[model samples]
Target chain A: MLRGFLVLVLFFLLGEALQKVFLIPVSGGVLGMMLMTLTLMFKGGISDDLASASQGLISVLVLLIMPGVVGVFFTADQFAGQWLAVAAALLGGTFLSVLSTLWLMSRVVRLGGGKGE
Target chain B: MARVNDWYSRLLSLPETLSASPALAIGLTFGAFFAGNAVFRRIGRPLWLPPVVLSAVLLAAVVALLGMDYKAYQQGAHWLTVLLGPATVALGIPLYQQMHHIRALWRPILVTLPIAATLAAVYALVIAWSLGATPEVLASLAPKSVTAPIAIGITQQLGGSVPLMMGGLLITGVVATLFVDLAARWLAISDDRILGFALGLNGHAVGTARAFEISPTAGAFASLGMGLTGVFTALILPLVFHL
Candidate 1:
């Protein structure tokens, strides 16, 4: 498990180095995830070490992100005036996007001869 | 009454010792999270009762009530923030496990992922812009569909406010996760893959977590959608919204 975590951290560091070198706009962690996915694909399977380590991290994924969410308290006052606009945009936009994506993906799947089940 | 007042005074003075301790910060965070999780589970895990949401509210309330500055809390809680990158990288495991499915349906996923991502961003920008949101807010709202880390990076690159972007991301995740079931039933969408993809594309990490509760296959597809959407948004947003 520790080895697997070290490997993940290595990948994340590599991603950060690559991002700095190439000036990629994406976050290094995301780039690292993409890189790890490719590595696993080519390797033909997930190692138990990696699998267990990742599972441990993924289980508490929400906990990891909570710090940033809590940071919102620092800037809550900024949105006080635009809360209505922000709320409308977030709620309205998210609803429409989910609805449309579902509709489009299903249509495309049906067209491709899959049951889309 | 006098003893109660002394206890209250002692409680107020506790921050003097506890405020600077990382252990206290971490302990408080975990305690709040577990408490929130207990409440959420006890309440049967309603859509609006996400553990992170509850925990955030709880933590914020505690900080405010204790009269502790946000920065002081952040200083001690910084360790959790450091793990965000690794947690994101760990997402690759699920994506890897689902590789065969992804390859089999690459045609549809490849075709639709970009379109779905673009539609999400465009809808957000248009709605916020028309509603008279300021430019900074517009930039932040534009990336609300992507996961929080990537969204924050995109927002920074576009010169938007990070805090506003975080708020937008949380709201987007909660709303999408909450309404996705109803939207699917209304649209007659029984395909778990499509539903999962839609959820991840719109809701990001939170939605993907919700998708996992439904099925592994759904969870896998949702992770793929989320990863691809993040990559696409990161690549495209800077080009379209050049500073």
Candidate 2:
């Protein structure tokens, strides 16, 4: 588990390094994910240890954002006057996005001869 | 009277310990999340009681009650904050695991995921702008459909408010998780692939979790959607918006 975790950390650091070197706008974590995905694809698969370590970390992924969420909560007063606008935009935008994506994907899959179960 | 004064002094000093030590903050985070998870389980895992949201609320209440400010809480919670990047990198494992399934539908996924993500971003932007939202709020809402870590990056690059971005993400996740099933039923969308993709696209991690509860194939496709959407948004949004 320790080795596996170290590998993940190394990938993350590599991602950060790449981001700095390339002046990319993307986050290091995301670039790390892309790197790991490519590694897994080329390497055939992950070792059991690596797999377990990743699983352990991913399982509590939501917990990692608690601090940020709490930060938002404390500063929520900044948006107090605009709650209505924010709500309308988020609700309308998300609902429409989901609906449109679902509609378009189903159509594309059908046209591609993929069976939809 | 002397005993009451002593208790008051101790209470005042509590923040010094809890809000100054990384270990204590980490412990508090885990303890709060554990309690949230327990409550979620006890409530039969309702859609509204997401463990993250519940834990954040619980933690925030505790912080408020203790008179500890956000900065102090953040200082002590730096350990967990640092792990966010690694945890996001860890998401690659599940995405890698689903590579076979993704490969089979690569064409559709490749074509659809980017469009879906762009559509989501544009929808939020246009709607928020039309609703008279500030540019800051619009920027924050633009990345609301993506996962939190990537969303935060996008928001920062776009000069949006991170707090607003986090709030937008939480709202999107909860709404998608709660409404996807009902909306699907209303729209008569019984196709697992479509349902899964929609969940993943708009809901991110939380939506993907809901997809898993439906079926393994749904879960796999949901992971694909989530991963592809994250990549697409991170790579494209900055360039498209000139951020």
Candidate 3:
């Protein structure tokens, strides 16, 4: 637990340093994550300090789904009226995304000197 | 303060408005999207009916109509973002579980990681350029498809003047979910492993979830792709942008 808190705090602070001083574009939270990842890599396996600290927090990641869930509170009425546009964007984006990326992915694999067949 | 919040809340909750809670609103929109998806699927329609995209679009529409600031919506969303830490940490657990396979795949992963990362960014830039998007947006969108917090970091550094790369992440997730299977099939990639990883690499969480639906092995690879992509993007994007 101590390790987790310390690491999280440490990473965030360092991230802030990079953000403020160096003006690195990534979020501090991410920098913190990367810092922690590096710590684990160097140390080779989780310490009791690291595991206990990180485990509890990692469990409820799903709760982050709330705010977006909450965004729906105001959108209830608009559902019926603009459902078409919403549907179109959703479907259209999905279609384009799937077709384009799939095609590109195959070409990429082949270009990389690999063949699925 | 509570009273002030309550008064403003009441004003916002007028029948002329939508739901008062962003969380509830989000939950309900997804609920409706599921229903919509059910309707489409029942009729044997295309799988292009995306629940997340549909739900988010529906939410954005109401925000536009009600003149609700993104701030108010995010007030409710702050709860969600706080969970990001735990979510990322959980990634460790799954990663540990798959350690053996990870060891075996390490070589290929190293070689492929940079290539995949570069392609995702380049494609994003290409699309924005084709669409004639503004420079700020192009810059902001470039590092998207990496991961949320990291994307946010890069966006902040670039002075992109936009919300973190999260919005773009969300879009990528929804898109990845819808198309992962199609891509896998199109490539004639017989292995589910490759399909899942590609989707997750390109899509992130949504793709990861889709990978889970396919099988555990695929899900595992997807997770790897997601994690590796974030790390690679962080290290390499700055170098690429500099060049």
| Interface alpha-carbon RMSD, every candidate | 1.5, 1.8, 6.1
Model 1 CAPRI quality = medium
Which of candidates 1 and 3 is the stronger one according to TM-score? Answer: 1
Estimated TM-score for each candidate: 0.94, 0.92, 0.64
lDDT of 2 by residue, B6-31 (tens): 99999888877666677767777888
C-alpha-based local distance difference test score of model 1: 0.84
lDDT of 1 by residue, A1-117 (tens): 999999889989988999999998888899999999989888888778988998888878777777678877779787677778888888888888888888888888888835333
Of the candidates shown, which would achieve the greatest lDDT relative to the real structure?
1
The residue-by-residue lDDT of candidate 3 on B109-128, one tens digit each, is 56666776677777666655
Pick the winner on TM-score between candidates 2 and 3. 2
Which regions of candidate 3 fall more than 4 Å away from where they truly are? A1-117, B1-46, B61-67, B161-165
Estimate every model's Cα lDDT from 0 to 1. Answer: 0.84, 0.80, 0.59
Candidate that scores best on DockQ: 1
Clashing pairs in 1: none
Model 2 interface CAPRI class? medium
lDDT of 3 at B199: 69
Q: Against the correct fold, how does model 2 do in TM-score?
A: 0.92
